[model samples]
Target: MAETSRQIPERIPVNLIVNGNRRTLDLAPWTTLLDALRDHLDLTGTKKGCDHGQCGACTVLVDGRRVNSCLTLAVMKDGAEVTTIEGLGRDGALHPLQQAFIDHDAFQCGYCTPGQICSAAGLLAEGHAKSTDDIRELMSGNLCRCGGYPNIVAAIQQAMAQS
Candidate 1:
């Protein structure tokens, strides 16, 4: 009988500009961006509601676009600018969306707030939503189990108007 050798998975290097900070990490090829952000880098602001990408609680900005962090592989986003909820504000000043969320009470449980804010920022940047219906359609991906859609839409509308 002949013995066969097993292959060992190799670690891949991933470079990401997160929250205005550059990070280089050597991680397993299978590591998801959400895991890298939450587990490795300790950026837990991105939630893990449903790892399958059905829920947008793990949403983040990759290269200025909203993406489900859990659905994106860390190695695939090399040289990309990644922005999580923690990156949205600076020096105790909240981002416009963040302030809007607060002003409108857009969150209740707060588990989905990060993703909601990130998605709203992306929507505003896209400049496609002009009405509450459009905002709802664009932000439908981020689910708040607390059922804060009305306030969420209001917050986004307020932020959009201000922007």
Candidate 2:
């Protein structure tokens, strides 16, 4: 018979409400929320860019507020509600922001689209943007190397107008 592998004793227990589903995980103390989502939970929609908070490609919503997932520790967000790009939609339909992004051609390389949409969703929920400039200013963290800022802003504006 094969011997069982040793269990990691230092792993911490964490509970999360991810995409409206309860998830329990035993993670290392230093595991970032982004790694937990992508590696452990298999939710790769939350990307890993720069591995730092400076690049908002790893943005996700924690308890309805947008956060940089790369810098946040998994244990810190235990019991929190996390929403990734995959969970942004409902009832077999794309999210309004997602549809708006498509309509406005908000992406060039498409790498930053997920984070852009997630940030846009949180921006709308935050209700801090009153104009186009406000949206541009607020969404500065998420960067697209392909220079798609104009279209990204347009998508956000469209979603805002529809809402």
Which model scores highest in lDDT? 1
Q: What stretches of model 2 exceed 4 Å from their correct place?
A: 1-9
Report each candidate's C-alpha RMSD, comma-separated, in the order given: 2.7, 6.2
Q: Please give the distance, in angstroms, between residue 115's alpha carbon in candidate 2 and its true position after superposition.
A: 0.7
True-structure Cα RMSD, model 2: 6.2
For residue 154, model 2's alpha carbon misses the true position, in angstroms, by: 0.6
lDDT of 2 by residue, 37-77 (tens): 99999998788889968879999999999999999999999
Error of 1 at 63 (Å): 0.7
State the local distance difference test value for candidate 2.
0.93
Candidate 1 lDDT by residue in tens digits, 65-112: 999999999999999999999999988899999999999999999999
Model 1, residue 141: displacement in angstroms?
0.8
